[model samples]
Target: MPYASLSEYNFFEGELKNLQPVYKVIPYDINSSLFTDYAIKKRFIWMPKDVQANYTTDREVPVFPIGTVLIKNFYYDNTIPNNTTYIIETRLMIKKADGWAFANYVWNDEQTEALLSTQRETIRMSWNQNGTAITTNYKTPSTIDCATCHTINNVYTPIGVKPQNLNKMYTYNDGTKNQLSKWIEEDYLDTKPTTINSTVDWADASQSLELRVRSYLDINCAHCHSTGTSCDYTPMELSFSQSTVPENLGICREPIDFVTGDQQYIVSGQDIQGSLMHFRMNTNIQSEMMPPVGRTIVHQEGVELIEEWINSVETTCP
Candidate 1:
């Protein structure tokens, strides 16, 4: 659907394979090795001869609109036959035309397991020609999240760690999928938030959440939140995925955070207590935000979801 194989569809070394209709991919995520991803530590070695030509040079078109194609028909349930709940991220970073792979993780039925099982998201890349209205190559993705990944760019930037409105594709949460703008589209009261929980087979997700969440936290917040880093002493080592972190996104790591007493940086459960998530969401000058470095303002829904999830955590984290 989205990729020729599973990971990236490499065309850098060889010829363009299946070039989807220009419109198939949204306008903004057109990052073709041209822009500088400040977070990228290693510069890519291979480059296509006509990297720029791939797009339609017309001014109004943004990028050229050759044709149209539908990679993933998210509309249809079970289009993804696997009983495993999917944690798919729209990773657009393609490596050497040939060096493309992805991770397709599997969650449990009803999707309530340890996190390790879903440590990896389902990732895929390809090298197919963009032809007609639809293609089935999407079924056999090569790899998972291993090949494709996020750079250190700020959240709001094109090359940020957090998933932005990339590829202009539908935004993916655990249960629902929709266009980012669609959330506010039409009447706000139109379609209420749907309850779309995932369904995995069994209890295999424990390790998935543990390892994957750790890996994610390592790549994402770990850079600055680790020992000796900005958040010294306080060891969150928190993770998110198929697994369940005790406080979820709580600022349990910091005792006095945004709180009145002891003078810590955040409070675990209280959003108003200046929890790390809350502070990160704050753009006001009066608020002492974190990362004060890269990343854009935190996603409001993400913050609220984390807060709600924290409230849902059992007193004991199994």
Candidate 2:
């Protein structure tokens, strides 16, 4: 049955505005996450009692049982005079016998309730970040938009629930522990490998530039760029496992569809200016930006990270 209001599901305890997860609903975070115009995201997974998700390969999504719900809420903080927080939307992906179903709930201005909505909507808001006032027209994705990215080979699937992304340590309400281990303890996952090939946190400068860049693209672009997806016709395969190969990252590969400026290769080694990937990441233009729909503004830090990685590459594309 479709829910008219978000509170109908009883996913959160106490006030709905608090956004706390209920006992069976476990909170989790990915190592490298998709950027959505700087909106902070909170993710949770809930499964039926005694049902556990089966672990697939590190790179593949976990096989979740039916009655599993992936919940994500998007919000912003430090808005207005008193550092008020405003939640924009909450997206849910529920696993059913047929397939995964997408639901989007838009929060009301009062911050009390969120109602199920299918139509596309935009909220104009401003927030303080690092003492700077930033404003944006935050876009709440329509159901069609959700389907566009979540669909893979005609099947709707969850993207970030893979072992590689969820293998990191999380500070839970009770205590800090590895997410996979916590899941195992909670009986949310059947079992995980002793040594999981985990993805690096893209924002961590201590990690290698290449790993950070690969992690960034893996979360942000790999969904569409992988085989059987929207941008699969393109040479690049941005998934972390495949991005280790230069060819899969489009190194020296010519852009087939379009070019920005004098861009020669999808990724020109040591030449950030000539790299199509860099240009696309740096732009906000709908036609030029990579993963264009989810973000309205350029992710400055992400672009800088890509630029540094490109400059570090020793191989110069001919």
Candidate 3:
């Protein structure tokens, strides 16, 4: 069943129930098509080598034509230029439904290079129009959006993916525990290893969770947490740097987590979990998860770091 029984005894669907989404992304393996998901996985990514070819990664679901208004976020996934990862959270059933609907919504796919193509056309026209137009002024979607999204998130997420738990402290695959590195060294993965400093213009801000976390919260959490929006079940009403620790203050927010020891998915807060973070990450999908737009997965390592950072909240603003 989509949503059997929440702590509230029933799920609550949000106003996002009317939209549907399709995805295209860069992939990891050069041998498959990224957009090959004709069967429609609940949550999955496009193959790096070919969007037309269908390839499935571990824990990736195969479902498409997600008929609902989902919160879609995009990324480049330089790790495998072929397919980028889009963190699409779904708010459709967060307010109106009675039980589990989906883990919000998220996945990986490509964008037909249309943005890149459009930029090229714009540049060509500029050249013909002025021949002396600032050649550097012409920008690509990857640049305009990538720099903003990545930098907006503290530039930690290259293509919207920060090497969460990266052991080397600066590199994703360099960590002794990073098994993914060995694959890259062996050329088994299309993604190349990335060093912490490898990111462009990262660390411009102080190396505090405030800066890093604030940036991420802005891009990831602020959409619904903002005023006038009915995102979370109880309406956490949070914004980046709004307080020294918005996410920390967000602890025990309802429809996200309820330490009252009573399950009420319909009302705010459910289960006796610590907060939405604990609940969202602890459980799998189709249940108490977040982004309330995309899938449930929580970006594994990314959440782990944010959780670690959140647990050690400081009064200083980020």
lDDT of each: 0.29, 0.89, 0.30
Q: Tally clashes: model 1.
A: 58
Among all windows of 10 consecutive residues in model 1, the one with the lowest summed lDDT is 30-39
Candidate 2 lowest-lDDT run of ten? 255-264
Ranking by lDDT: 2, 3, 1
lDDT of 2 by residue, 1-318 (tens): 349899999999898989988888899999998999889999999999889999979999989999999999999899876689999999999999998998899999899999999988999978997888888888889998888888889899888999999989999988999999999999999998899877899999898878888899899999899987777889888889898898888889998878557998888888998999999989888888877789888899999998888888788777
List model 1 lDDT by residue over 62-127, tens digit each: 121112211221111222334222222222333323332222322233322212221433323122
Model 2 residue 35 lDDT score: 95
RMSD of 2: 1.1
What ranges in model 3 sit over 4 Å off? 1-206, 232-235, 245-248, 252-273, 314-318
Q: After superposition, how far is residue 74 of candidate 3 from its true place, in Å?
A: 4.8
Over 4 Å off in model 1, which ranges? 1-219, 227-232, 239-252, 255-267, 270-274, 282-287, 314-318
Instruction: For candidate 3, write residues 1-318 as lDDT tens digits.
Output: 223212121122232221222232111211111111011112112222221211122211111112211122222221222232322221122111331122222221232111112111111111121222211122123223322322322221222122221112222223433423533443323342353221111123455555565545544554445443344344454443353444333543335444433433221222223345445544545445455433323444446545665557442321
In candidate 1, position 55 carries an lDDT of 20
Better-scoring candidate (TM-score), 2 or 3: 2
